[model samples]
Target chain A: MTEMAHALRVQNLSKSFNDNSVLRGISLDVATHEVVCLIGASGSGKSTLLRCINLLEPVNAGRIWLGDEEITRAGIDEDRVRQRIGIVFQAFNLFPHMTVLRNITLGPREALGLSRSEADERARGLLERFGLSEKSDDYPDRLSGGQQQRVAIVRALAMDPELILLDEVTSALDPELIAEVLNLIRELAGRGMTMVIATHEMSFARDIADRVCFLDEGVIAEAGPPDQIFTAPSHPRTQRFLQRIIAAGRM
Target chain B: MGDTKRSAGRGSRLLGNRAVLVSTTSTILFFIAVAVVVALAPGSDIVGERFLNWVHLKQSLLGTATAPSVAEAFLLNVRMFMIAEAIILVLALVIALVRGVPGPVFFPFRAVAVVYTDIFRGVPLILVLYMIGFGVPGLGLGYVSTRSDITYGIIALVLVYSAYVAEVYRAGIDSVHQSQTAAARSLGLSRWQSMRFVVLPQAVRRVIPPLLNDFIGLQKDTALVSVLGSIEAARAAQIYGAEQFNYSAYVVAALLFVLVTIPLARFTDHLIARDRRRREAGGAAPGALGTAAGAPHDVPGAIG
Candidate 1:
């Protein structure tokens, strides 16, 4: 593959919670406009790694580069770094008190300092794209799980970030609702939005992922194209995990 | 059909039970006995004289005006009580916001707040007023000028009510869901900004009804200012009734209090109903999601 320009690079990323080491010397790189999937069992440091990428959870020791921003250095302006990265949580953490329109507009208006009219116009366009135009006035509690998660994606997109990190976006939804949210992500991947998703929806990953990295015990056990990773994972742990998840029809 | 008829028949039999009749009759008798005892108790002649003397003392309070002494007394009492209660509420909210929640740096502040609340809540308002109005001056704090009686009464009220209001605010703050804070922070809002924009707005909404109830309590408790010889409404009524040997003045004062409290109580009830409706509407939308997923986790837990 052409050395597709690097959008993010992590070297020696490590984190420990008291006696428990959550991430151990994890190193990875993602190309610009690429969709990378990190798949792993529970407690394998997938979520922690995602959080560390945005400096939401400070890593114990590591270097992270978002383009050339050098995010892991001491006294890095976190707000500036965060402005470039958008994250969506499993909980669909939409501000409850705000209307769907306001929820999508808040970060852009506040962080990007967009004028109200501009923010509203951008937010309206995004909502329309997500098929949530009619639900703008309603609160998150008013929306279905699939609709709420889709709104969450739009909320992150409104920031116009260089990269988006989605942590277990479908894990919290019903089986039927999961497909709708995954479909939205798949659409985004097809449009080449430079995304990193930690998900158990293996079928979507197989279909949309440009590359897949299997994380085991705080490190990437294997990383390759979707075809090789799914059908011919070289690592024994990756093979076993794929077998268990496929058998269980979830991970 | 047989089971339904049998249950209905059993319900009728229970309704006619003698024990229920005896308990209802005894409750009525108890209230009647208390009323009779209160009515037969010594006439207010002795208390009437004392009340008259008190009224005379209050008449000179604002210094001999054409304002009916009774009206003047009532107004003065009300003014003093309102001033005191307002100060108490504002101070209590500030204290609660600063020191009520659990935090390392606020531990000492919280401890101090607890002690302050305990001391005032533990002692009677009358005792607090007496100390500030009379006791301190006796200790060469110098007879607090009669002009300052209203001020002293307000201080006393603040000291006492702040404790109660603080607890009310503490409960309101604690009621906010931790997830709201987490969500706000994850969105990159600083701690104070999260509190200002998110938590406090919701917390304040939840506490409004209780805060109004506390206000009504404070209004009624304005009677405690009487111990300090302030011309508050209740004291004014008592004094006027004593001098004239007519209970109408006291009744008028009670009516005035009801006038102030009733509207507020009604407004509070309306607010509570409106809030409930809003919550119900917010929750109703999630039921649609329920059908999509057998059980999607609802916004997990009570919002502040």
Candidate 2:
């Protein structure tokens, strides 16, 4: 990877909640439009690292540079930084009270100060592209889990964000619905949307990610290309982790 | 209930075998009618002459042009209720906002909010009315012009009811999943924007039934404002009844209050039932993830 051509850089980042340290000395760099997948067990701090990069959770120590901008520095506006970087959660937190169209348009109209017609037009286009145009008027409660998650991705995309951090977007879906959300991610990747996804879908990660970072006990135990990590991970911890995943038939 | 009904059909009589349910119910109704007829008859020891005399008559049924009666005073009650309710809705929301404002920078304001909620909520509505309505005027503060007692009474009601309402709103806000705010924040909404545009809309729906309960309470308590010297329905009834030596005017006011409150109360119940039915309908979801690792909504417990 060309480090100077990086779109995102996190150098020696650390975060903790009440001395229960989550992310410890994490460091990584992502090139423009590169998709990096963080694969780890529940307590390995994959989610925390993503949250820290988003400034959702303040870091205990470290630096994160978004392109040429140092977003972690004090006096920097967090919301402006967030507008450029969309983050989607596993719960598909599309505003339940809002219809599908409203959910997608809110961020653009409110945060970005886009015109109502402009936001709605773009949101509708995204809705149609995602096969959710028919359900645009329906509330979040009306959508299936897969549809909600897809709409969530569309909501993030509506911002026209440079990077998207997806935190286990399909973990809550039923086994059958998981494929629907994963397919959407696959589409995003194909379109060259840069993303750092913290996910449990190992095969999906292995197939889609340009580089896979395996986090173990709050640090990256292994980082490599997909084939290397999936087939012949050098780190014993990465090997053991993939072994457990294979035993469970999750990969 | 089904099992009990089947047993009852097998002659397991709850009332009596000879007294069939329909005849027993009608006989009970007949006895109640007999009692009403006796009391309503020309002269009865159980009911006073004033009640009997005022139960019917054009003057009691509709107030006279020259006198304070239910018809004339009903508007006062409505005026107070509408104004207090409108003010309370806004004031309570402000109070809740002050109470829940984030960060240590607003600690003093939060403390003031806590004290305000604690004092007004505990001081009793009557005392608040007495203090603001009567006591404020009694202070002889020359700069403070004594407005109409009705205004002072409304202010007091807003003060006290707003405290109760603030607490209710806070509970509703607390019940909202933190993830809702998180989702909004991740989308680049400001803290206030997330709260105002996301959390509050959802919170308002949750607190509507309780807020309406307070509103109905406020409606009835409009009578309490009468003590502050407003000749609303209750006070008008008191005045008319005192002169007429009949309490039917008070009954008229009570009936009117019941008429207003029953519909509002039933509407609140309807909203609550609808909300619950929607929730129980299944996990298609309403967007709140309950802050679970995965949105643990329709599952009802921690999702595996």
Best by lDDT: 2
- The top-ranked prediction according to DockQ is 2
Chain A only: give the TM-score of model 2: 0.98
Instruction: Show pairs that collide, candidate 1.
Output: B77-B231, B77-B232, B176-B304
Candidate 1 residue lDDT tens string, A1-251: 67668999999999999999999999999999899999989899889998899888888998999997799999887766777888888888887767789888877777678999999999999989878898887767767888888998898888888999999998888787888888888888888899999988888888889999999999999999999999999999999999999889663
lDDT of each: 0.78, 0.86
Interface RMSD for candidates 1 onward, in order: 6.8, 5.4
Model 2 vs. true fold: TM:
0.88
Candidate 2, residues A16-40, lDDT tens digits: the string is 8997999889999998889999998
- lDDT of candidate 2 vs native? 0.86
Q: In TM-score terms, which candidate is top?
A: 2
Model 1 chain A, poorest ten-residue lDDT window? A137-146
Q: What digit string (tens of lDDT, one per residue) describes model 1 on residues B1-304?
A: 7876779878787778977899999999999998787656696455455433554445533323332455556676568667877677679988887774556978888788878988989998888988888865566644455436677777888888888888888788778886576555555555666676667766776888998888888888877778876667667666655555655566556667788789999999988886786567545433221233123344422221
Off by over 4 Å in 2: A1-3, B1-44, B52-58, B64-67, B141-143, B283-304
